[model samples]
Target: MKIVAVLPPVVELPEPSPGYLFNVERAYNLHEYFASKGHEFVTLSDAKESLEPHLADMSIFICSPFYPAYLTKELINRSPNLELAVTAGIGSDHFDLEACAARNITVAEVTGSNVVSVAEHTVMQILILLRNFIGGHQQAVNGEWNLPKIGAYAHDLEGKTVGIFGFGRIGQRVAARLHPFDVKLIYNDPYRRKDLEAQLGVKYVSFNKLVETSDIITIHSPLTDKTDTLFNRDVLDRTKQGSYIVNTARGRIMDTAALVDSLKSGHLAGYAGDVWYPQPAAADHPWRTMPKQAMTIHYSGMTLEAQHRIEIGTKAILDNFFEGKAQKQEDLIVEDGEIVSPSYKIK
Candidate 1:
């Protein structure tokens, strides 16, 4: 079976670096690994390039969530031989799961491949926003000492209310790491786990309450129909005034325009995260110029360690798929024309 990987252009490091494990040319070492097995493997550059040109005979489509080639219904239908859609890292949201299921295409990701990486990044962004790190850092770089400007927005994480919108692995990890910071933890999820609440010392709250109560709202939820633009104008209006937001989840989960508007209106004191919508985000994306933004490219999950874990998981999934063995239960998003993972449930 032919495998086509849609990844960003390779980073040509002039010198060797251990961190280049998942670059397009290296690709978690899949090219050499698969080549020895007599299977065809190819790598394409960038997310915007049309996959249609290469999809005609491809059986496996592998892509990273960091730079995705969105496989819509039309794109999915282009390849009758395409049986599997694989995420090199942990998010399969780039795939239209419903469309894949309708076409009996299996969608799977390297589950837990970068949960800790993302969780750590989320916490870092939270601190960056709450403590006014961006302002201070910019002042230092600009060769100015403006304590009043930076100190005005600087806040202590201690004794603050932090509400996590999704209580999944990444969210749980964030809560665990933040527990010692003495922040009051609250969360809202479709499924409530009594065990987590007891162990993590967190309480379940309604969606509205989560926004209204949290001094800092950190989003770790997946992008789904219900969560698409879930944090819109109305929700931003409900958020605690002067509160900060950190989203390591998909960018579409928040309204692009509303987020900027809130920051401009001072409703949200700051907004920070690494994820962005239509990534390879346009040069003129408003979020880039928005005040008090601590945003970065969507690469929190692409750490070298995470890339190694992803390599293991991706190899396992591909090995299973090619050998006609069963895929990992936790990794299967769609199978046999049905959505198997509960994480994608719209309601």
Candidate 2:
């Protein structure tokens, strides 16, 4: 079988120490593994345009959420031999699930691969925004240490209310990690688990209440039609003035314009997230110049450890596909034009 592995540009890193699992030179170790197993492997930097030449021969397509090669319905229909789509990490939203299901292309992801990494990043950003660490760090780097100017916006995490939207695996982990910080934690999710809420000491509040009362709001929800632009001007208007937001989930969850407007008007204290609406966001994207933001290139979930887990999980899914075995039912996002994940079901 022939496999085409599509990924972002190669990143050269300093040589790893002995015993390190990741070696910088041999990038995409999984590609090497599949090649050794007698399968033809082809790697491409950007499959969006380059994939056309290989679609006729490629049997399986592998991509990552960080640098997705969007598989449109037209593209899916064009690839007569394409059988499976594998996300190197969690979140299958990059692949149009409905389209994949309609075309009978099995969609799978490396679920839970980066939950800890992203949850930890959420906590880091929450503290960074809450304590105004970015401003303070900038002041120090500029060789200016004005105590009052730096201290004015900074505050202790204790006693402030923190609300998490979408109490999924990552959200639950964020709440559990913050429990030691002595801050009030609350969350909003459609299907509330009373036991888990009590265990985490997190209150299940309405979406409006969570937005209105939270001193810091973090998003960990998936992106769907219902959650697209979940945080707009109306939701921001309800937030406590000067509150911060940290989103490690899909970027489209928040309206970009509303976020910028709130930051400009001083309604929002700051915003931080590693996800962007368009992966490899356009050069002139608004978030690039948005004030009081600590955004990066959607790498929160691409840590070294995460890469290993995703590589292993992706290879396993491919093995199953090659052997004509069914995908784990729990791992199937869209199998045949029907939503299998309970989270996607209409209430």
Candidate 3:
């Protein structure tokens, strides 16, 4: 059997670093393991290349959400021998799920592989914006120690109300980490988990209530039809004046234009996040120059530890597929033309 690992472009590591930015060390391991099993592994930097030459021999395709190789319906249909598609990390939005299911391609992701890593980054972004750390750091780097300018926007996280949208694995972990700060926690997930509410001491509130009351609103939801553009003009208009917003989820979750308008009008105190609507945002992306915005390339979930776990989990998923072992039902997104996960079904 032949497997093709489609990964993001290899980036030069920082000075004195021994690994590539995307970290292909695990891909090397998968190659060796699959080779020993008499399977061929061909790693490609991009998936745009026509697979007509190799599709007949390819059995499985491995991809990562960090640097996704979008598997469109046309590509899925072209791969005649493809049996399984494995997402190296969480989030399979790059895959055309309906197309894959129609073609009988089993799709699975390494669920919970990067939840802790992302949760930590979400908290970091929140602090970065709330405390005006970026502006302060920039001032220091420029050899200016103006306290008034820095202190003008800086605020304490303590005693503030934080609203979390989508109380999933990452969301719950974020709430747990923030609990020690003595901030009031409120959440708005479609289905409230009673156990989580009891354990985290988080209040379940309506979406509008969360927006109106939260001093800081952090999003940890998936990218689906319902969640796409979830934070639009109406939602932004309803938010408390000067409230900060953080989104570590998909960039499309918040309407970029609406967010920019709110920030321009001073309705929103700040906006910070790592993920973007289109990965590798264009040079003209508005968020690049938006005031009071702290944005970074989507790397929160691509930490070294998370990458290691992702590699292992992806390999295991592939191994199971080749051995005819069923994938963990919890990890299966689309199987045989049916949405196995309720999250996708309801959305």
Candidate 4:
């Protein structure tokens, strides 16, 4: 069987780095194992047009969240031999679940692979925005130390209301870490996690209420039909005035232009996150120079520790498939010609 691995373009290093475990050029050193079994392994960057030619014949395709080869229904139909799709990292939102189910394609992601990494990044972004860290740092670099101007917008996390948009693994972890900050936590999720609410000391609130009440709203939900552009113009208009936002979730969850407009109009105090729309963002993307943003490339989930966990999980999935064994239930997003996770269903 042929395996096609989709990843980001490799960085040029003067010498081979032993610790660069997740480079696309090396295929996470997967060739060593696959070659031993006489299986063909191919590597490609995430661009779909370049990957189109190989889709029909490749038996397995591996992808990562950092550089996704979006598996749409059209791409699924074109790939007649695609029996398995493996996500090297967490979150399989890039794969079209309905299409994979219809095509009898087994889709699995590395569950819990980057939850802690992302949760930590979420808290960092929250603090960066709330404390005006970006402006202060910039001022220092410019050789100006004006305390009043920087402190004008700075605020403490204590006694603030923070709303979590999803109560899943990463969201729950974020809440757990933030609990020590002495902030009131509220969450909005379709499925109420009652036990977790008690454990994390959070209140369950409606989506509208969460938006209206939260001083700092952090989104941790996946991008789905119900959540696509969830924080568009109408919703942003009704958000608490001068509120801060930290979205470590999918970029499409909030409208890009609407977010820029809100920041420009001073309706939002600040915004920070690592995710963005049309990632590997263009040189001229508005967010690059948008006022009061602390955005970074989508590398929060690609930390070295997270990469090692992802590699182990990915290898385990591939081993199960090659052995004709069942994959772990927790990691299976779509299996046996059905979408197993309600979070992925088309709403």
Score every model by TM-score.
Answer: 0.97, 0.94, 0.94, 0.96
- Candidate 4, residue 325: CA error in Å? 1.2
lDDT of each: 0.90, 0.83, 0.85, 0.88
Identify the runs in model 1 with alpha carbons over 4 angstroms from their true place: 47-50
Name every residue pair that clashes in candidate 3.
none
Please list the residue runs of candidate 3 whose C-alpha ends up more than 4 Å from where it truly belongs after superposition.
16-28, 49-57
Residues 1-347, model 1: lDDT tens digits: 78999878876678988657666788889988889889898888764565657778999899989988888888888888999999999778889999999999999999999999999999999999888898888889999997998898798999999999999999999999999999899999998978889789799999999999999999988888899999999999999999999999999999999999999999899999988988778999999999989999998998889989999999999999879999999999999999988888655
TM-score of 2: 0.94
The alpha-carbon lDDT assigned to residue 121 of candidate 2 equals 92
- Candidate 3: tens digits of C-alpha lDDT, residues 219-252: 9888888998989999999999999999988898
Clashing pairs in 2: none
**Could you tell me which 10 consecutive residues in candidate 3 have the lowest summed lDDT?**
17-26
Residue-level lDDT of model 4, residues 311-335, one tens digit each, is: 7898899999989999999899999
Off by over 4 Å in 2: 14-27
Of 1 and 3, the candidate ranking higher by lDDT: 1
lDDT of 2 at 319: 77
In model 2, the Cα lDDT at residue 114 comes to 88
